[model samples]
Target: MWAARLAAPCLLLAAATAPLDARAAEESEAQPPAAEAPAWSGSLAAYLNLPRGNEAYVTGIAIANRGALHLEARSNYEGMDAYSFFVGYNLGVGEAVRLDFTPILGFVTGSTHSVVGGFEATLTGRYADAYIEFEYVPDAQPSGYAYAWSELAFRPVDWFRIGLAAQRTRVHDNGRNLQRGVFAQVKGKHVSGAVYWFNPASHEQVTVISVAISF
Candidate 1:
């Protein structure tokens, strides 16, 4: 009788704990794994543009972390003929999209100085990526100017991408110009490279090549 009584309690305790064990197993299977923390990242790039009559080179650097402040700078190689500095906040819209709003201060060494504001938004997915940017500068280049650029790219693999880009700029008294181009880019663990061919409606075509390093 004593053995039966002890067995009865043991069975009750087992019955009481079985549901909890089952629930814990179910919860474990249903819950997603924790995500790893993001780290700081940055890149530096050099660009060469070849036109019919003139060749120009530009160097740029940018640094940012996840959901943090971003800093960027760009200048031409010819005595920093054209230079720009940007300060911005980076925001992630979703898992695959990010937006940066920045204020830019720029100068052309002996020509003009201006203040501008801009935004760049990028969408990255498994097979493709797209980017758009807009900038407005008051009293720039002897007059006010606005610029917009958009690109859509497809990535066939992890490293290579091909894209089409369109860019437009409007300048006071200088008229508006539109350029369309195709670009190919390759990215590795720490190195990236791209080439672009741009054709303007009323001007000669231009070719640009760029290489970058990331840290």
Candidate 2:
């Protein structure tokens, strides 16, 4: 009789805990996994203008997770005409599209002393990139102006990309000008470089080369 009573209580205890153990396991399985942490990255770039005989340098840093927040600064060593700082955010629309919005503030050396506001938007995908930008300045030389640029590129190998690029600029007094050209880019693990050559229908030719390093 004593052994029978001991076995009965042991069976009762196991039966009571079995449901609790199963419920815990089910909850664990249903819970989602933790998200990965964000990463920080930065890049430095230099651009050389062949026609203008000027050089511009730019540096930027960003933190990326679901989206990226970045700050960039640019300066022209030959002159201060293109000195500016930009703050921007990059948001992923879906698997292949990313959008960026940035605000620009800069001075036009020997021209407007006041800081002006400018806006830039960029859309990028696997094979193409496009951007529209404009700046507001009361005393700008070309008057109110804006520009749009687009490029479609294909990667034939791991490190080389070839593309066709087009650019349009609209100025108040100068009218609209369009330029089209071909571009090539080569990329390495930590460095990349690109070159562009465009000729306006009735204007001077423009050439630009840029190199960038990432860390």
Candidate 3:
């Protein structure tokens, strides 16, 4: 009788574990664990500022992003010796014609100190894209000031772009408040280089060389 009793308990224990293992496998298949979050993509760009009758300088900018979150920094972008940091959210809209905009808020430091507000927007079509950016500085000397930069680009091939560029700034003063020019860019897998010639007229010509890397 003791032998049969021991065998009975062992059989019952095996029966219990068999259902437990089956239930665990079923639950695991029904609800899977979540996946890891997506990674951020970003870029850094440098511009070599060369203008007629002015000292040469370099402008640096960096951006880090994850999804809709945007972060950016600039040195010597707003003015000479100036630095700024910005936070913005990327908003995208449209299908046939698309628009992407980032309304950025930042603080200026180093040269001209102030609170800055602006937006970077791009309108895209079949073969061309139009981009515009503006920043307002309420604490500028004398009064509030606004600066703008714009580009209209046409792409005949995937890796090359020809564009018309315009800007209003005090960053480089060669006796002109507004500068307009032509630019061409050649892009590789992760790097791009562009040359801009502003005020193409011989009198107050300005040239800018841009090199950028994306990750």
Candidate 4:
């Protein structure tokens, strides 16, 4: 009878202690470390280019986290001069997928009109010292047509970059057209300048030159 009593108390103690130990282990397993957030960056750029027959100039500014705001004034001496504003958001930084929106105002020789708005999506990839970006713009009226553009940029040295880009546009009613262009750029620590040839259409082209300083 005494031995039976001792065994019963010992079994009860083990059962209670097992549950407490399991609860402690489960508490430890539930806790984990927290994650960190990403940082933001800003940039300003100026450009000059000649697309088929006109001279164009632009000054662009960007203030962004993962998202960006772009504002620019574009002028073509032989054609229309436009002021453009846009918003661009990076879906993933240093990765594929980006989104853009642009609204434009254009004025020329004797007429004025709203250039409408445009939206775009882009994907990017890199290989060795060269990187390529693919962009798709959807169909929009008055100022935009559906288009795809591909660009490749190469870094000859740390602060100098050169690139070439090709674009094709499909109009809702007119027809299909193509543009081919080349660009050369030099970027310092806080400022950058670019020279380019922009052939926006098969028969229309512009040439432009510009300079910008940033803080």
Could you say which candidate leads in TM-score? 3
Clash pairs (backbone) in predicted model 1:
none
Ranking by TM-score: 3, 1, 2, 4
Q: How well is each residue in 1-215 modelled by candidate 3, as lDDT tens digits?
A: 99999999999999999999999999999997898786898899999989999999999989998888999999997899999999999999998799999999999999889999999999988788899989998987667788888999998887888989998888877767799999999999999999999999768888999999999
Clashes of each: 0, 0, 0, 19
Clashing pairs in 2: none
Minimal lDDT window, size 10, model 3: 168-177
Runs with alpha carbons beyond 4 Å of true place in candidate 4: 1-40, 51-61, 66-88, 93-144, 147-150, 167-177, 198-205, 210-215
Better of 2 and 4 by TM-score: 2
Measured against the true structure, the TM-scores of the candidates, in listed sequence, are 0.67, 0.59, 0.84, 0.44
lDDT of 2 by residue, 33-77 (tens): 898876667778776655433233232222222236655555542
- Tens-place lDDT per residue, model 4, 1-215, is 99999999999999999999999999888877565555455554444443443333343333443324333333321123423333444433343433233332222221223333333343333321333322222223344333344555676576776777655533111232656777676778777776656564445664445465655
lDDT score for residue 22 of model 3? 97
User: Any idea what lDDT model 2 has?
Assistant: 0.60
**Model 4 TM:** 0.44
C-alpha displacement of 139 in model 3, angstroms? 1.0
What C-alpha lDDT do the candidate models reach, one value each? 0.68, 0.60, 0.91, 0.47
RMSD of model 1, in Å?
6.9
Q: What is the lDDT of residue 162 in candidate 2?
A: 85
